[model samples]
Target chain A: MNVALRFDPVRLPDHCQDLRQEVRDFLREQVVQGVYDPTARSHGYEDICRFAKAVSERGWIGMAWPREYGGQERSFLERYVVSEEMLVARAPTRRYFVADRQSGPTLIRYASEPIKQRVLPQIIAGEAMFCIGMSEPNSGSDLFAAQAKATKVDGGWRLNGAKIWTTGAQHADYMIGLFRTSQPTRENRRHGLTSFLVDMHADGIKVSPIEMINGVMEFNEVLFDDVFLPDENVIGEIDGAWKQATSELAYERSGPERFLETFGAMRAFLTAVEGTDDTRLQEGLGRLIAQLHTMRRMSVSVAGMLEAGREPVTEASIVKDLGTVWDQALPKELRTLISLMDYDQYDVQAYRERMDFYTRMAPKLTIQGGTTEILRGIVARGLGLR
Target chain B: MALDSDDIHVATAERIFSDRADLQTVAHDRDGAYRASLWQAVEENGLTIAMVPEEAGGVGLTLEEAFSLLRAAGRHAVSVPLAETMLANWALAAAGLEIREGVLVPLVPAPRGHLAIDAEGRVTGVCPEVPFGREAGAFVALCDGPDGPVIALLDPAACRIEEGTALSYEPLDWVHVEGAPAMASAPAGTAAALPEMAATARANQIAGALERMLDATVQYAQDRRAFERPISKFQAVQHLLARLGEECAAAVAAAGSAADTLSRGETGDALLLEVAAAKVRCGEAAEAASGIAHQVHGAIGITREHALHRLTLNALAWREDYGTEAHWALKLGQLVSAGGADALWPLLASR
Candidate 1:
């Protein structure tokens, strides 16, 4: 490893490192052939996912999954390198990243063997997509008390509830949802919840798109009306959904992705502005870049922990809590410079689409995966605080 | 690239001190304990004598290794007078003076105090604001020599300490020094270097505490819900907390790097410029971070019962010490003004 490049010491497999060149080669080829525009990279999920699928075909998707699932049997380091490169490339991989990184890992850890065998291959192949169904109305912060209900039925259970602010659910194939299984009697309200892999296409499920502030329907409100599930679809032990899913969140919340959200924009802004004089942008950008480096180091350190077979729950919580906010604020600081700068190939509308889209979606990056508050509670608990 | 000893902050220094509640409690008092336990552990770990030449009855470690230790201290909030004592020992060692372990308070020149190198090789004077004066066993006295203010080591027994002053930490008092031994005079602003060194030290400490405070505040905001959601999800507060964190981190890197420059002996206006910039920025950054941290934390953070106050208090105290925002601003302003107007390019290029 080049010491200059070492912000944090997460282990990447020797092969994973080679994957960087592969991503670059492919991206370079696309750019050379005028097949993809770097300026339009972050705009649409479908376009971004198209690029992700290209990389996925090279055995990058679910790279660390078992070979039985058509995965490359690679390491987290390898997957991390690929993810980071995609961000640096400023290409959108929003569509399938969640399923591959956290949802797949969650299922592998707590899903029934049947569920894993059924879903892992498809997820690894980039054919099936999953969105989280944790947050809901009246329970946005208190996720466990979510009114999403799963009543007992003849063969399995009937799930009748709604999840709001669901990201990319309009396009997702399924949701790994945590619904209330047992009755909520103050004490057991949180403990009685169970997780299920609900097919979004199943009967009685409704997906209505929720346009974001930036005017995109990348997220939606997923309403479940007596959506039934087979008993075999239960994730982990009954009412242990919270436990099963919280582990996945640790994976979700940490890593370079949390903080690196706006690097492309920031870099684009940097390329736009040239004078290192007393301009506020230079000062702000300098501080921003330095701050970004620090967060990256912390995130990399957490990556190192996960690589060593440690969950690094508290550390990951710290990273996500810090990273998401840092990532989101970059554009707010750089918007002026971004306004001044122009891309070589992209027209104003194309560039505006990418910038406006990411800016709208920026707010949820912190709220989703895990809310800052919930992560802090975890950190406090890690500190043995009440 | 040659990394300055102060620039490299490593994590290996996590070994000696307690990262548990005991240290946190000591760090959180209405007036922190001055972290005596942590200080002792640091001394044993060779932080005090870490960079002294082996012949000087020390561990003889390189400044490169020591800076890594310093950065780790910044990260962990290890608040003892590590840098003050180190600068003192470095001065003493450079002077070829024999020494033993104890606190070395800093003395700002009294202005009226005259510097004289006696035939017997004894130097003496009275200076003001000798840091930790009431508690330290020795004082590094800065007095007006013919050339300028030269810093000399004074025996603690040779000076008289007054009652406690109006300081936040209620640290040791300033002393009136008379006759002290083994003193030597150097260039005019040699003693001024003490603040830069101290600035480097306190700035990092300031950065560390700011980091901890921001971290604790952010975590608290996220977990403690208000109006049906984590406060962190609120767009306004999210912006506030992110800015706070950025300020904290900028201080860390700037201060760490300035200390690195000083450690590498990048002297004169060049070194002073970086130090002054860092000092001013760090003071402002620390002040802003601590204030915003308390705001984000709210009433719960104000209680003596909460650990957040420890880092905040440390930040409040550290920023005021060595140099405040005004003090460094004046110093930097003088340099910038002297360099003429349209001067940022040359100044930056020189750096």
Candidate 2:
């Protein structure tokens, strides 16, 4: 009956610190080699995928997974170090991020041996990319309301529906898609859905890029017209994906990416304010940095909980809620502080551009993965309100 | 990451607070028995000197254990200077000064305060507001000495004391010193660290108070009916409580992280970053969650008879203790700016 939520202090161990430095050095070297431009603010498929391959060679992708699956079997804290470093450096980890964070782990937990043998190594090796096909046009936040169907066939299920706002779907080699495998019981609307590992290269699958407000083409509309997924592709129990999906959210919703999305803007803001005695600017940066530091602590705590085999669903949701909101506000808050500075004195034109880019990207922060509303609901349920 | 063996301390605190300092008991206690009994229990448990090293004639609990204890005191919104006394003993002990017993309040003179020590080691200064100061047997003052920082244990009987009250009606007294001889004075490194310690302590208390507020508000929402159903069933109410939950989580995380950092013996910018971040974050959370808690509770929440005000008002008052969010935020901002942009991430990731 205690409504207290726990986010225990989870300091990354010495190993994470060592891994962090290596990541920073690697990223710095990549920047020097023109593998990617930190100032460019965005990286395309080729640049990101190549960088992913290099990162994988360092045994970072799926570093927390088992060695038999081409992983280092490192702690989640170590993986967390790699993630936050990639994010802060703007290293375009999109190619391996999903797979490293969730998909590979999901496969390890539930995939068939052949599927695990085939996919996890590719995922760990950074050869394969994965996308989550959860949001249909009508069922973005209301995930259980997804009408995407997968009718049973002789040897598999035939998928027929569409998933919108699927990030990186165009280049995805696989998708952990949620589809209707049975009718919903009156008692439980969430009981009917099933999750499948669909081969993206299948004949009936189609991927169309969708441009976002930030001018990024990462979002996609994936169409499944008779796209067949074999029996082995089913993850865990059929018609019980609600259970798996809920568990997966703890990993997806809490991460450095939730709060560090607009870190570039913050870094630029710091550059602009450096060597200046502007109280307003310093105070602004201080507040943001404080919030950012706290978010990282919370995120790390959740990661530690996961490492210890505890399901910190509520804590993870709270992280995403607070983190996304803070990240979303970073640009707007920076803009106010920037207004107080003399542009010519600070030489902040590039900083201004970074702020603009983050401003456009901010809207989706609380919407993707889990909308703020949905996250709040999850937190509410955690509070025993539901 | 669970408290594990530290659970004994938290559980002890929980037991003590529930028995002697429950909201209703403290709210309506006209005879001051509740406050006195709570203090007695805390003292009996040897919690006041928990931060002082065992070799220094005290319990010598780890800073982490002590903080968890403070947070437990916070859950009941106990309006005593438990944190101040613990911190005072800690500072005195760290300075190798004899630990003072009985209601010891701390005084870390504001940057602008007139508190000073002359060559003769006589204390001359004024602390405009000190929580539980009127009742303190002795005052632990961290001030500038001619050579460096010094920690002085001052006898209240020699100094002028005036009683005041915070918004929560707890004792917020004023103390004046006209070159009063210190009972004991020692050159202390803890002087410079006092503010951060005090702020971190307040952050821990605020985090605890916020958690209690969330608990109370959520309970109230469920029990209070509106439009033919429990108000909690409404999405608006649930979301507000949810946001309150978020604030509580952030506050706890921030405070806990700061406590962990201090317990590890970190100092300088490393210590400043964590403590400043904790104070600022917890202060913000207190302000935010306090309002949401009241909003969810409605008219009764504002009434004196209601216990909700104790938690909310104390949280607000604690937000100003040691340093307000703005105070620490500005300090933190200056620190970050000094490090420059390139060094910022490394500073944050240092933990």
Candidate 3:
């Protein structure tokens, strides 16, 4: 008889609301300081570096990480709460993400004590950037076929290969590289790979920007030629790389960032249209709003698991899949919506650049960390679908 | 960010119901006492009085609270007059009866006849299928006037509960009255309150079943091991459960939104759409929840001994209680059709 109703969402803990306000205040201060413009930060990524530094100063970065490594060590739900606050503020937030969402945990799981101590402090401080190196030319859909190779040398490894789509490579000081280590006998190619942490400054390591369909050089083609990594740089055990890579990928795959890409625009749309009693707008808005709300809850739930010390890979996969569809749906849905009204058609132009920007950037949404097809296969295989 | 009493209320409701309404045990009541007790508990908890103003001697929680609470009730799979009670309360309130002090209300969604209570308080009605008519105090309906349906309060003493092996074991009956005194409607927009009024308890039932279904499926996934691992680890089960979880989450959010909308006195086709969607989804969700749960539970789930049948049966019963999928679907279909061919464009343009 314990299932009696005594709770609801409107009744969130008082502390959560307070935290939300605190984040709002910080965001307001940043806006007052003109650290980020409304247009630039509406999508939440303008002063990405400065934003990370400021957030770290407040101990907001790595809020859920253990305090020993410069994290505030808050509950996952509380972290989720902060994410919501940041979203509501529409602040630029790309920089602190790795430290907050992934790197903190990745180091805990896969890094050596030295690496955790050396890299985590800077990461926590947002002094270092990491452009995740996962995808290659033919390896977009099948990530394990990464042709990137790291040859064993005396007391070190000389990594030699190419990573075609590395996000933030221009600024990143280091890269988490998946490479072929053990020789594959054709049949067991996937299991033969190992992961490495390569210094971008190493000899012959080249980072060339790849202009995307969005016309932004946010992605890079990284080539490693005789780039030697000291034995000390080996992040995880040899041949046991996929486990580490997967744990890192799980962290990469989940969170509110998936659906929150266009949340600000949606809110702006809501605020701007208050004067009208348009029936068509309400119906269209209702369906999409409902979907966005659904995606957030699922994403939040997965974050809850991450906070609870559980690896919710399958859960994360579901969120990523659904979130991508909804995110991409923004443009398609708006296009359909725009064709209806003359007013919306003009307003659509006003928001067209950003929408187009988001649309092009969205293909990377699924393809960067893991392609949708690949993730689906993983999910299906995980679910015994195959 | 603070969770209101609504969430706590649902948690408390589901906890109590989940414990008692397990499938193997509910058969003993055979009659409706179990459901009656459950319904009274709901009333005592102030769920029944949710819409009444605080001065009216009720808990005065919003409709959202009622929606979530009833959903929890649905999850417990307890069959009763609970949702029907709200329909009746709405009629009484519409008929100008003090919900706390007057006779129990008649809850049938479409009232074919009327109950009339005059200033002298003489009551009369023929409200067939009025819930708990044999064991209630007041009943409210609308008698026909020169202008249409007029609100009427009726004496519970005048009505009767003629239960004849009802479907799904939740008690059902009719209230019959002749020459009942009739009162006017409550206020403006009261005529349009049917969708909101009917949706309150029904939405709750859906939320409850959704919660129960999710819990049962999760529990089964945990309990049932196959191929050397718990079946939950099976990616296919994970995907199915994930989709079920998505449906439940969406329903909970929508039902909550609809309840909040109703509380604001906003009644329109859109509001109807929200509630109707929740109803339809909840019905489907409950069945899916139960089916996925039973699937995970496997053979023992099909047996009478397993507690899942309580959840499944309630899901089955609630589907038909107020309206089935077909009923709500047709309602939604009509609403969607209102947009004409291009109706979907306006609805979709909400950006």
Candidate 4:
């Protein structure tokens, strides 16, 4: 199989410039209002919710979905511009990012009309938040090995297993949970798994915080003790979620968030060495900037492909793989360059603090959405090596 | 590799390269006998003057079409100076000078080697490591004249050509000149941005070479076997090829973005940023991809008999051609720093 990977050079449309200015103005207003610090590692939940609602009021959230679903019916490139602007600004988008990026799009495709009508409007209004329930104690990268059983009941299915590393589960309003409905067939081990839209406030569901090394409680272990999910909550075909799961990943993995996570620290680093005449630091900064620019171009190209109604799975994987690795290494490289400067020369203390946080956060960049190894395996499959 | 059949110019270039400049045939022709026929085929098809305007006695392809042709030349690892001739003709056309036929090379003076034009319009300076300088019939030199930058077309016989070879075995000679009369000259104007131009061209070539390297490495993995199975079955080899694919993708994206920027008739800082970034990124990708391709192919890749080194070595050499990674990286860093911290995102997102 001759799989010549193509990344057609896609320029942002003329309308996107206006959209970008709008986003920048909105973000600048938020910064001026003290909504959140763009350089901070995390934002308060109140500010996050406020920012999400503000973005939704502007019709930025769910802008790419249909108008019937409370969306603005804009192009995916418009959504891309807004998403990247928010990420680069380090805006508090944690509240509605998952729903807008992956869950909303998944519901638009797989969720029933009733469910879409019920939950999508709230998500589009930025009143709803979502956390994925794919990884468990044993199924980190091997998503099909999930043991979260959803036993059949009279009017619904009962979920009885736990999911680990569920980001934002403590405050999430909903979850698109994956559960094992039956045993895998010999022909396809990815069989028998199903997806359900579960209310996070439901009874018998417990969320325990998993504190990261950076002393952040962003991850959680969610336990469900026979929680009932109605039949109407089922998304797409039962026992065929494996097919649905892969498509959503293309959306999740190729966004600007994958690389812009450490951009705050990069900004801080530039500020720290603002006036230095060191050629080594200059060269390092240049290399980092170039890599970042290339990754952005690749990500934008993938978004363009999606806007053109094409599924660029391998291309998205390539972006995520390269983007994650670059971002994961960015903080360390910045630290080395920053270390070369005099400690008291500039505002090195704040820069060091930010770098410390980003360095701690870097380990999860490659592991969060999908591990680097899994991405490479996907690319290898695209190369027909499998 | 899947050719973009929709692009007729790219299709035509690919057809010619596959017919005349196949890697296997070019690799075995050690004495450079095929260079003449290959260049002849390119010139006869008007590929060298593809960038020159139609009003100026040349076949005028759009910037995008011309870049696509360069990519095809790189994919075939053609030893001829197709890209140089195209660039030289482009500079000549921009200056309203007569576009010459047959193997015209462009020479942009490096940081230390500054070629200067005297009051009499006599060009005097040594241009070190000029690609295809030994083989070209004429030199299109963007020199620093007394008044301003001047574009001078010089005869190869007027300069002393000390022949050298790049890592890919392409002739990259050092040309020494003392008061050589300019055959033709014009103000540089917008064409003074030859360094960025050359960087963009080299970036395109590197991207093309990386694509071919990926194709060749993947093919080899599926054919070469070990332990009763193809080595492609091994996870280690698969990962290596995956890394190669990533490098190739990065180079393509960066180079493609640069080409799009140039196509829009953008110059100054925007063009500088895109071209610098492309050169730096594609140069780094060349290093990574060449290393990975060689590793995957083992020792057989380094031998002269194998076709892998032709592309790999050329990619390696292309990294240093139009501003090495370090050179462009420093320039890019200065640009970014000068833009200040807050302007970084806006600048990147502008494109």
Query: Which portions of model 1 miss their true places by more than 4 Å?
Result: A1-22, A33-35, A41-49, A151-155, A225-228, A335-362, B1-47, B52-204, B207-285, B288-351
Return the candidate ranking by DockQ, descending.
2, 4, 3, 1
Error of 3 at B153 (Å): 5.8
Strongest candidate by lDDT: 4
Kindly report the docking quality category of candidate 1. incorrect
Q: CA RMSD for every model?
A: 10.3, 1.8, 8.6, 1.6
Query: Candidate 4: where are CA atoms >4 Å away?
Result: B1-6
Q: Retained native contacts per candidate, as fractions? A: 0.00, 0.81, 0.04, 0.72
Question: How close is every model to the real structure, measured as TM-score?
Answer: 0.64, 0.97, 0.66, 0.98
Candidate 3 per-residue C-alpha lDDT over B202-285 given as tens digits, one digit per residue, 9 for 90 to 100: 655666666666666666676678899887777777766665564555456545655665665666665666556556655665
Query: lDDT: which is higher, 1 or 4?
Result: 4
Candidate 3 residues lying further than 4 Å off, grouped into runs, are: A1-13, A41-47, A87-90, A183-190, A245-251, A344-348, A352-354, A366-386, B1-80, B86-201, B207-242, B252-351
- Supply every candidate's count of residue pairs whose N, Cα or C atoms clash at under 3 angstroms: 4, 0, 78, 0
Per-candidate Cα lDDT values, in order, are 0.64, 0.87, 0.61, 0.88
The best candidate in terms of DockQ = 2
Candidate 3 per-residue lDDT, tens place, A1-386, comes to 22221212232245766786687688889889988765662333447778888887887777777777777777776777777667655676756565567656776767777887888788878777776677887786676777888888999898888997777787677777778887666666567677777778778988899876655667789988889888877767786677676666556676777777766556545443333345565456555554554455456546656755777676677667767767767877765654565664335555555556666666666655566666665554443334
- State residue A324's C-alpha deviation in candidate 1, in Å: 2.7
Worst 10 residues of 2 chain A by lDDT: A1-10
For candidate 4 chain A, the 10 contiguous residues with the lowest summed lDDT are: A1-10
Among incorrect, acceptable, medium and high, the docking class of model 3 is: incorrect
Range of the 10 consecutive residues with the lowest summed lDDT in candidate 4 chain B: B1-10
